[model samples]
Target chain A: MKKNFKLVIEYDGTNYAGWQRQNNAITVQKILEEVLEKLTGRNINVIGCSRTDSGVHARGFICNFVTETTIPPSKIKYAINNLLPNDIVILDSSEVPINFHSRYNCIKKTYTYTILNREEPAAINRNYVYHFKRPLDIDLMKKGSEFLIGTHEFDSFRKIGSSVKTTTRTIYSIDIEKQEYYIKFNITGNGFLYNMVRIIVGTLLDVGVGKMTPESVKEILLAKDRSKAGMSLPAQGLCLEKIYY
Target chain B: MKKNFKLVIEYDGTNYAGWQRQNNAITVQKILEEVLEKLTGRNINVIGCSRTDSGVHARGFICNFVTETTIPPSKIKYAINNLLPNDIVILDSSEVPINFHSRYNCIKKTYTYTILNREEPAAINRNYVYHFKRPLDIDLMKKGSEFLIGTHEFDSFRKIGSSVKTTTRTIYSIDIEKQEYYIKFNITGNGFLYNMVRIIVGTLLDVGVGKMTPESVKEILLAKDRSKAGMSLPAQGLCLEKIYY
Candidate 1:
């Protein structure tokens, strides 16, 4: 029985190399595949909703895998989660259509970046959150986020080694919200280039620190060059919020 | 310059032997005291709100120490918290009256025991929570909590090797609150006999599983023998909530 299963997963990502497999490093896909193989004497490759970068967290990124084992979808989560490490959790697992690919058939994806916008270093969550001591203008950050919405040629924000050729991407929304010690940037888009979210965060941080104006974001997007954007922020602050396929 | 200082500290407790000083094992008090000796060159002793058992946690358990050094009270927290490990966070520190004590001067103490009420083993908080497979009836557990109120001689609940001569204590209240995957036993008391909270949790488990009734708690309390009480719960689920001095 070729069973197509969909899975919703959450992970810390600090210990993992990335979603993709590597020869020398531990990866999320490799861990899951090894766990499944241990369960049913056969190797099954799990496909992720997104190839999340190193140190990027996730709340509910989707995945799909085909297996010939007779195990039901309901028990798959329990079986896999039991074997997985403490940092990763499988939220929900179900049988879906055979044609429903986690990556290609996706409708939209949402990501969130968190900054511990305070003076003191993050003691407990230092690995998960980025700590910024500099005072950030919240209103200016909001304005910068406003300029990020809709279709734009985000060539300036794309990473140098991005495999994709197209730089034009449609962002559904960009929400900048802040609490006492935390600032969150929620971004929804159809697709993203390699290290796109991190570069955008770096630019927003530049805008927040008064180095650049909110209106300057438009010019940076239009420039369509990597040098036109700010440096790429670390991946620890970024979280894959969800995947809608 | 003999300064009497108070501290409200929080720790994961997974890495510590307990709050007391031991010869070889790692302890929170030992860590703080060693750091104090290194910085000030005087072998200073650190006192804690309680001798929290190994693997137990704390949120705001008070501790006090005296030093002759001229390190200002406002700066002590900065110096100590900086030296402490990542799992420990000094929330506040201030100069206190020389007459004040962390343990004896407290009005009351509050402790909470959390049971991860789920089928799957806890992944993220495996060290911080206790997992249970059996379902518990919340209303029945609430009924059992009523028996723990007021003054009682809880000899059965105390550990057999406890040095304390008196077994009589006053339990202010017992609150059983359930939310999703957690069932918390929030207990406040004038003072607790050795391992009283752990035994109480074990007895409550009996109540939740239908082996014992809520009214049976009195009979066990009056038994005044260690064998009459339920088994002692694991230390990992217990947390010293606060020392209400």
Candidate 2:
């Protein structure tokens, strides 16, 4: 009998091409599929909840796969974790409904972008954060983020190359937190378009640095022009924090 | 005229041969000296507060050097940092008294050892923490730590090959903090013998795991035998947090 398994994964995506499999580069999916094939003695197809960009990290990434192996669900995490590289870990594994889809069944997703708002860049966490030399105005950034709180057409916040049936999405919340020299933006939404979160963070950062006004965010959303939005932030600063079912 | 400068540095020591300069292996001091030489046309010698083990990290490591360069002390950090690798950063630099020394004038040092006490190891911070599979008893570790506070001979904690003038050191405090799956031991002392902090953490971990009782710490200290103490933990889990002058 075949069983479906859900895996809670955590990875340092610095060395991966992205979450998806690619021909020319290594990816988290390819590595995982190879390990799964080795463990179960069968070809595997793993479905990831988010297609995280290159150099993007994940704290609670969700994925699912069906397998004919007799290995217990609880033991799969330990077994695969031993085979996976140190940069990727299976935090938990469990038996799930056979038809449950990792991407389609997800209700909401949360992402956090960290900025090292200091003069000197950090050495230890260099790969985990973006370094911004200017002093950020947290109040202005918070006020600017208010305009992007509700459901809207986020056409201006997505990469130009991405194509979707609808560019409209619901943003649940955007929380800007400053701890010492680090600024973290916690964003949750029903869905995100390609590079949507990074562009939104960059737009808010422009407001924080007084390059753009808080009121301009609403105009940018209404304009529906990608060029009107701020530049896309680097991928390393962004992390897939959680996915709610 | 030669000017004495003090620099507060931070480094990810994964790729180096420790803080000290060596002939064959790459070291943090060697890198800094090379950068300094490029900026100023003189060979530089940097004195560090601690000879941190290979693969040990630092947050606020203090060091000093004398240079005859015309670059302002405040700008030296920026100048050298631009030439240094991303894994090492100069947090701050300033002119200091001519006779000041980083190792000799240090009053106290604070180090933190982080343990990821969970079933699986972490992927994002794999280089920054030590993963322990078994559940640790925090109260037992705390009880064992109390005996190590105050002045005592730490001969049993040092590595066997280390040649120290005296093994007696004053431990001001040892605070154990647990947040979720991470257990951090913050230790402040006037000085530390070679591998002393790692050995001490190993002893406390043994007590926490019930392999040794809390009372055994006193006996271990009294015995002053290297074999009586627990094994030395890995260097990656240890970090030099701060140095006081």
The two-chain DockQ for each candidate, comma-separated, is: 0.27, 0.85
Clashing residue pairs for model 1? none
Interface RMSDs of all predictions?
Answer: 3.2, 0.7
Q: Candidate 2 residues A51-165, lDDT tens each? A: 9999999999999999888889998998999899999999999999999999999999999999999999989889999999998999999999999999999999999989899
Report how far residue B23 has shifted in candidate 1, in Å: 2.4
User: In model 1, what is the error at residue A104, expressed in angstroms?
Assistant: 2.4
Please give the distance, in angstroms, between residue A70's alpha carbon in candidate 1 and its true position after superposition: 3.4
Cand. 2 Cα-lDDT: 0.94
How accurately is candidate 2 docked according to DockQ? Answer: 0.85
What are the lDDT scores of the predictions, listed in order? 0.85, 0.94
What is the C-alpha RMSD, rounded to one decimal, of candidate 1? 4.3
- Candidate 1 residue lDDT tens string, B88-116: 87777899999788988988999999998
User: Which candidate gets the maximum DockQ versus the true structure?
Assistant: 2
Least well predicted 10-residue stretch by lDDT in candidate 1 chain A: A118-127
